[model samples]
Target: MIRSTLFFALALTSFSALSQSTLQDSTHIDLQPVSVKVYFAPQSLMSITSSTQVVGPKTLTAQGSQTLVSALNTVPGIRMEERSPGSYRLAMRGSLIRSPFGIRNTKIYVDDFALTDAGGNTYLNLLDPLGIQSIHVLKGPDGSLFGANSGGVIRIQPKGFDALENQVQLQVTGGSYGLFQEQLSVQRKVSDRYQFSFDHSFLRSDGYRENTALNKKTLQTSHQWQVSKIQQLRLFALYTDLKYNTPGGLTLSQYEANPRAARPAAGKIPGAAEQQAGIYNKTLFGGLSNALQLTESLSHHIALYGSYTDFKNPFITNFEKRIERNLGVRTYFSYAKPEAAMPWQMQLGYEGALGWNKIDNYDNLAGVAGKQQAMDNLDNRQWNLFYRAQVELLKNWNLEGSLGLNKNSIHYKQRFPEVNNPTGDIKFDAVWMPRMATSYQLNRLMALRASIAKGYSAPTLAEVRSSNRSINTDLAAERGTNYEIGYKFKTANNRFIADLAAYTYTMKDGIVRALDENGAEFFSNAGEMKQRGLELGTWLTLLEPRNFGFVRELTVQAALAYNHYRFGDYRVANKDYSKNKITAVPDWVNTNVVHLEFPQKLTLHLFHNYTSSLPLDDGNTVFAKKYNVLQAKLNWNTTLTKNTAINLFFGADNIFNEKYSLGNDINAFGGRYFNAAPMRNYYAGVRFDLK
Candidate 1:
């Protein structure tokens, strides 16, 4: 009761301040009138490509999300996985294969930085959510913009300078459950011809699990200059430093005892007296890109980026020591002109990445080093091409299509100090993958889209080329094809937008079973399977613009999906294997949200989500229970002085305290498991933003 009273007191104080705040005149970011219409971008946001969706910063902030998994859960046809602190495993378009390390199937990037595996099954930590301006999720055959590994592509864009403006802002926030975050940003117009901008954020969370902790810091910058009336030059750079603790998985009994508990120390036995015995992991990466615009009718963008990843599990003797580096480049060109049939535009591009990996394995007993085990040195390279054109068929009709081709190569060199194995020396192999898609618009308010494309995932360095004791070289790249159709509609006031889509994905000669027999798992023709689904979504303003309406602003939105899957032809026991239902494909998933704004300074929000039961695996093993979660929050903006303003927030997640998991891997090792979700909790914060 006392805690509640204190909380409300703070809310009331801030509410009063917000009512009298004078900063509203200077607090806007986009420089548009509060009453102006705003619509999310296509190709970047929803169903234009059929099973994909885009999330913008405004939506993110209104949701008041804390983790990537939670932030993305509001989307349809997308599944988010949070196995441990700062680690994620995302499966899209019905993909369910696990790689030797880090995430599998889905490709994740932040400003073109490939957060590949550093140690075992690793990737980049989710950066500060408050600093993000938008995210694009490309589903099925986005290889045209991404690569062939592109079952799905997640892209992020930070805030940037607009057509006009020089603005600077800084914000700091502190909340419950040991949460803290701060962001600083600057955007300056050198002239009508030049602009500069930069953003940085720092965040920390103690987390619900005892050992599930996260710490992250990030920096992003952009520079643009107009060298000629029709030409422009742009430069981009980013840096991230993250450290997190890996909470070893637990058995059902252990979970029942404590869901928010981890191995006393990563991999340490219980009742064994020890200090600071846990697996500590950290990663750092940086990148840069440059783009140039040519004539008004022709523009080309070229980018070069690099990343370095390193990780160690010193506590686990004989565990491989790993280090990797990747360098890549990309170029894109676009042209637009009037034609007899209609106005048309063309786009073409290509990108490549080269990666180097090193791993050292040593023999050891009982956490004590013994003899040298295995050493590996390898290189990985990739290249791809993209082409597309869009044309207006009539005043209200439009057509667009694209094609993409990608190639991947891997090479290995091994030098054992004491032992030598047969299989020759210094070898290499390359694989090629291709894809394509097209769409047609019926009118300015509606469109029809369809796509059929191919994609592939090459064997990672740890899978094909690493000499680590558990490295597997007998595996082949996973191959698959994707198909989809979609429709979209929007309101002229930009207050409402809706989309519907359907898709099917099939994987032939799929790659499965990893690290078995000490990473000696051999590849087979494997099984052919298919996943089919439908997604429906919408964003709308329940209350019209105050300038032309009778009430305050109210926004309501929802996303929903339905899915079905089946495993097709394959050899299970040497003979032709037959029918079986694919597992883990939930029949339904939904997200609904409502937000309200009053005349003075208060915003009220509510959100809800639901997911149906799903099988544990492709074989239709055990089924997980269906579940629902609810969240609500209130934000008050106020000022205590002419120059000082205070913003306060109060929120709760999973208000019903539902217990569920998004991704669980029980067969990982010795009857252990990872959960998909955590229990609910309460949170509140105070924010101070200034010039």
Candidate 2:
């Protein structure tokens, strides 16, 4: 399999080289400056002091990524995994020890509106890749500005409503494992001051493992109105209906024997196939945002958002149902002066969220609800106030600082099997976080930076009221401090760029997940843990457009990360795990991408990824094997006429056919840790645009 994959890659490279040799030269295309808005204020990527990455439409289209994991896997100090279709978890400069199913300890936002609930859970899978125009990722703890996150922040920006002309587009894709997708989009310029855009997508797949199937539909719309010369109003809405089956994890022996088999029946518990374990979700979300230019050098912005969700899950032991509602508001004020000798900027903001949930549990009898077991009502609230300032200390030096105050609380009331202490509440104390950073530009091509920051993260509601039907009143919030230094460099012509960073953090009261005999999950606070790592990223332009025959452009990008994480002081069941390697955190990760572009808008991409083996459990008694994967993509775009265009794309993943676990069940019972990823897959798609 490895040999075949290598041969295929070589053939593609050779073919592209031959074509380049026979073609004529074209005009050179200069790289544009990339800007991001999530960093307190809009700034170029190279000017940020923190370790950050930005992905725009060009990169997204080149990769032909179907999920967020594929789009972000090449980023340094970050890892995204999919245990099964519609199930994902993300880890940034840390380990996934606390996240068993969804994203945790991370803050997510969409154009100044919060995507994370008050309970600190983010449903990132609900958004379709086509609807997003760009994504910004801030690596490491950033609680000082984003609030209540130890794994950093992610801000997604959707396609804008403004359009130079009215247009419509349609796209269709199909691939292995019965994969199919369809998308439709429309943009309209209703008037000089009003514009809107709408998008809808449908996707389905018959997965590789038994009981693993996915079906999802998404609808999104955005509208913008220029209320006045100095004011603007924007509205955003989204709806999603998603359903997917869970194949469950398999033991190593079971995986070797039949990787496609579902989890077998255990004693009295039913098998995954019999129970039809899966999740069903229907959600509606909307937001209203406004920007007002209060004065020549001052601005004000505010946003109001709300969401409703109906969710259900049927598992081997039980069936669960939840109805949730969330409401939030965010407001900010900013002042800036760029023309003065000592230019400065200041921003102050407040964000708050309220959530209410009604949960019910019942016995699962062959994929059906049998007898009622428990019911509860949960209320959660969180608020944060933040202030940030940036000033120019000298012609080539800058100083930035931020501070935030956060408060979170939760209340629970039991309705079924009522007993003593049926109602309880937990309120965490208000926490303060502060950050200070400095950047020194030695020259136009290089910069040096350093920072120190504090971080805090509260336990999610799911961790307090666990799947085992137990309330963990002893759980506490996690707190830590991080220190870092970084260096950035870019060539004069922007032909080469490099970023390097190193950091270390020590955290107390670290949350960890555990499973019981029946496969029910729960959480507990570990004593302490420490993490240290180095991250490096570089991009080199090997061939310039007009200077290299038919090759419009050729670039190579690479990222490498090294992590050393361990338990400082921890014990489970009277056994000390201190000095043990952190669970599910690879010691080293490397990713490389090769991009080639030719005349007539033809593009080709090759990707290679490697991950080192690491421990799978707290005790370090089990480990997952390391693996490498190679992928390739090709795309061609053409203009049929002045008002029509077409694009075609084809891609293949895991071309080596290596059998590896995309996501592992950490600290699983009965050694059921392996969930095999797809071996080899291929996809092709075409799109049409009309104006």
Best candidate (score: TM-score): 2
lDDT of 1 by residue, 120-223 (tens): 13363535665566676666645555565646666665555335346555666665557777777777788887887787878777766665566777787767
Q: Give the candidate number with the greatest lDDT.
A: 2
Candidate 2 per-residue lDDT, tens place, 1-691, comes to 3432453354345434533453333333333245566765777666677888876666666665457776677688888887777788888888888784478878888887899988787888888888887778888788878889987888888765434358888889989888899988888888889988888999898888888899999999988899999999999999999999999888999999999888988887788999999989899988999999999889999999999989888988999898989999999899999877898999899999999988889999888888989888899999999999998889878899999999999999989977664888889999999999988888888989889989899999889887887767899999999999999987666666778999998989999887777778899999898999999877666566653458877876677889999999998788999999989899988777778988878889988778888788999999998888888888899999999999899999898898998688888988988898888999999999999
- Backbone Cα, N, C clashes tallied per candidate: 12, 0
lDDT score for residue 117 of model 2: 86
TM-score, prediction 1? 0.81
Off by over 4 Å in 2: 1-32, 161-166, 190-192, 547-550
